[model samples]
Target: MNDNLAVLRGYFDAMKAGGPPAAMPFYAEDVVLEVPGAHPAAGIYRGHAGVGEFGATMARLTGGTFRLVPEDLLAGEEHVVTVATASANGVSWRRLILSTVRDGKLATVRFFEGDQALVDQVLSA
Candidate 1:
């Protein structure tokens, strides 16, 4: 496994162990995070500050039930794609986050939600 892949693993492991704060160390200072859909948590988050804001926004949107559970991790030359499920209440939605890494830190993350309807319902509820 490469360093980027290892970082991806560590990110997920940390997320599982704790929460978003645990994974923030793996992100670059100028990291960009894109959360999809037309909900409260759907926006463009930038930098380490954005990481904390994004988590806080998600918590509020999901009423503190939102959780990311990674099911797969794929690594390329400069990217690591994590297939994770975002669950809230009894609804679970899958998403693919393509993370671009630079200097052992995640530079960007683009999220693709598998179940947009479910995501909408959960976040809009």
Candidate 2:
């Protein structure tokens, strides 16, 4: 893993271990998180308020745990691809997130959930 990828992974690992507060260090002031069917987060989350809201929602729906486990790490000129497993809600889903990093911070993250059927079943259960 390159420096940026390592940093990004560290950020995600922190989220998995300690929730939002631990993940705050990896985001920029103008971070943009694009989760499907949800509004975008377009600014700095100084605390865990915004991030917590998002996590709580997911937790409620999943009834298990949701995490981003990077399978493939690819660094490009300004972006990276992190193929991860989003397991929770009694289901395991695979997804790919394309993120653009600027100044060592995450500027934008575009996530594509791969198994819509499984995700729907879990969320609707």
Candidate 3:
């Protein structure tokens, strides 16, 4: 695999193994994470601390049940698109992650859910 793809794969592997804290090392110092929805965790998270809060908030809101299982990764020169299943509290939905890598680090990530309302309902509960 290419370096960028490898980097993303490593990040995802870290996440799967140990959650956000384990994945933090793959993120750039000024990384930005954009999460879409009307739920509490839906917002733009900047830097390591913000990303940590985002993960913590989601975990808290979901009672630590939220999980992501990656199914595919498509890479380009500047970005990688990840297709995954996101689940919490027995509800599951397809999630698309658009990620950008800069200088071998994850610089930005924007999440797109297949069913926004379903995700909102699950998290809001």
Q: Estimate the TM-score for candidate 2.
A: 0.76
Off by over 4 Å in 1: none
| Weakest 10 consecutive residues of candidate 3 by summed lDDT | 12-21
Better of 1 and 2 by lDDT: 1
lDDT of 1 by residue, 1-125 (tens): 78888999998888878877787898999999998887878889999998899888878877788778788899999889999887887788788999899999999999999988778778888
> lDDT per model, in order?
0.87, 0.69, 0.92
Give per-residue lDDT, candidate 2, residue 119. Answer: 62
Compared to the true structure, candidate 1 yields what TM-score? 0.93
Local distance difference test, candidate 1: 0.87
Instruction: Compare the candidates by TM-score and give the number of the best one.
Output: 3
Pairs of colliding residues, candidate 1: none
Candidate 3 residue spans exceeding 4 A from truth: none
Q: What is the TM-score of each candidate against the true structure?
A: 0.93, 0.76, 0.96
